[model samples]
Target: MYDFNFHKPATLDAALETFESSDDGQFMAGGQTMIPVMKQRLAMPSDVIDLGAIDDLNGISAGNGLVSIGAMTPHAAVAASGTVQDAIPALAELAGRIGDPHVRNRGTIGGSIANSDPAADYPAAVLGLKAIVRTNRREVAADDFFTDLFETALDEGELIIAVDFPIADAAAYEKFENPASRFALVGVMVCRTGSDVRVAVTGAGPCAFRVTEMEQALAANFNPEALKGISIGADDLNSDIHASAEYRAHLVGVMAGRAVGRMA
Candidate 1:
């Protein structure tokens, strides 16, 4: 890894102040993506500010028709929380299915979403549930937060505080994951609340996005059969050695169907 100064601030204000003072600073949350990149000399920030010591950025609460997860809370905490399990079983299930035990214990939801990896699981859930991402400065709707591959709407030095997910009437997620990495080759999240339906897809595109046709069809008839002829074109999707864009496009429908079926 490149030589860099490290700071573990106990409070958000201190963290922000440190970042502002550095010539080039990067926040480290769980260090899942950041550390690996640094080791490869892919990233060389002047300073690394760790968010782990901030007490305010850790916790999970469920109530008032919402599941509020603190930014620094690990994946294992979300997967094991009785509150998450009861309030949104699909969400808990999704968290449980993330990369193995070590990654789960070390990876933070804030880092996952903030990194905005196209194949990451949390972005699908966030977009599917239409959750609100709360940063130190402002609240961003999930629809507007993810911009593109490994990118987000966050401003420079902005810190995500928490994510608030509304409890949907019904929800489910299905993913065709790469066996080795457990990263989604193709993943879909289906959520229905009242008369609204949302179908979000990950892994196939530059970023997690909604399938308007599937959403419209499901809103009219929430069933697998309703998605009969629905399919997204492969022109805009990712094509890697793991899976072709055409295959990912096909899996999008299959996964969406399976997710909707699971919600039944």
Candidate 2:
């Protein structure tokens, strides 16, 4: 890694101030992706602001028909939280299954969302649950939060405080993961919130996005059979060495079916 100033601020204000003052400063959350990129010299920032010391950025709380998860909260905490499990077992399960034990222990929800990896698991849950991302400046809806591959609505010096997930009537996530990395090749999260059905897909496109057509079909008939005739074109999907765009599209449909099946 290149020579850079490292600051571990005890407060959010201090962190933000340090970040704002530095040129090309980066926040270090879990260090899962950021550290690797730094090592490869893919990203070289003048300073690194660590959020680990901030006490407010950790924990899971659920009440008032919603679950609020701290931004810096580890995936393991979300996976193991009794409150999260009780209120949204599917989400808890998804967290448990992300990456592996090591990654889950080190990765933070905020980092995952902020990085906005197309194949990351959290985006599916965030979009499906219609969560609200609370930042140091303002709250951004999940729908408006993710912009594109490795992009988010978070402005410079804006730190995510937490994510608020509204409790849904029923929800489930199914993913086709790459064996070695456990990253989703194509993941689908299905949520039935009251009269509305939401289907969010990740790993198959440039970013996590809601499938309006699938949601409309599910709204009319909340059954796996309802999606049988629906076809997801491969043009908009991602194609990589592991799988073709068409294969990813196929996995999207299969995962969607499994997700809906789990809701039964």
Candidate 3:
């Protein structure tokens, strides 16, 4: 990795102050993606502000019909949390399936959602569960948080504090993972809360997106058969060596069906 000043701030105020002072500063939360890119010279920030030391940004809380996950909370913690398993088992399952043990232990929820990797798993859960992303300044609904590829609604230097996921009445996640990397080639999350039904897909598009057609169909009948004829177009999806756009679109339907089946 290129030479850069590193700061491990113990408080949010200190982290913000250090970021403000640097010409170009990048926040490090678990360093799963950040470190890999930096070593390859993809991201060479003047300063690396490690957020791990900030105690307030880590932990998991569940109550009041919501599960609040601190930004720095690692995937492994979410996977192993008894509270998460009891409240939202599907979410726990999704977290457990992300990468291998090393990635799970090192990747943070905030960093994953902040980086917004098109194939990342958390985005699917965030969008499908209608979660609220609480940042340092304000709360952003899931629909408005993810803008595009590797992009978010977060303002520059605005840190994500936590993500609040409302407990879904029923939910499940299924993904066609790339065997080597374990990244979703096509992942789908289906959830129903009260009368609202949502279907969010990742790994197939530029970013995680809701499938309104599937949602509408599933809302009418919350079953695998409800999605019999529903399909998403491939025009805007990613077409990589791992999978073609059309194949991913096909897997979207298959995965969505599987997820609904799991819920049933």
Q: What are the models' TM-scores?
A: 0.99, 0.98, 0.98
Clashes of each: 0, 0, 0
Ten contiguous residues with the weakest lDDT in model 3: 226-235
Pairs of residues clashing in candidate 2: none
Per-residue accuracy of model 2 over 150-187 as CA lDDT, tens digit each: 99999987899999999998999999999999999999
Clashing pairs in 3: none
Where does the lowest 10-residue lDDT sum fall in candidate 1?
A: 1-10
| After superposition, candidate 2 runs with Cα above 4 Å error | none
Candidate 3 TM-score, C-alpha based: 0.98
Q: What would the per-residue lDDT of candidate 1 be over residues 2-120, giving only the tens digit for each residue?
A: 58999999999999999999999999999999999899888899999999999899999988899999999999999999999999898999999999999999999999999999999
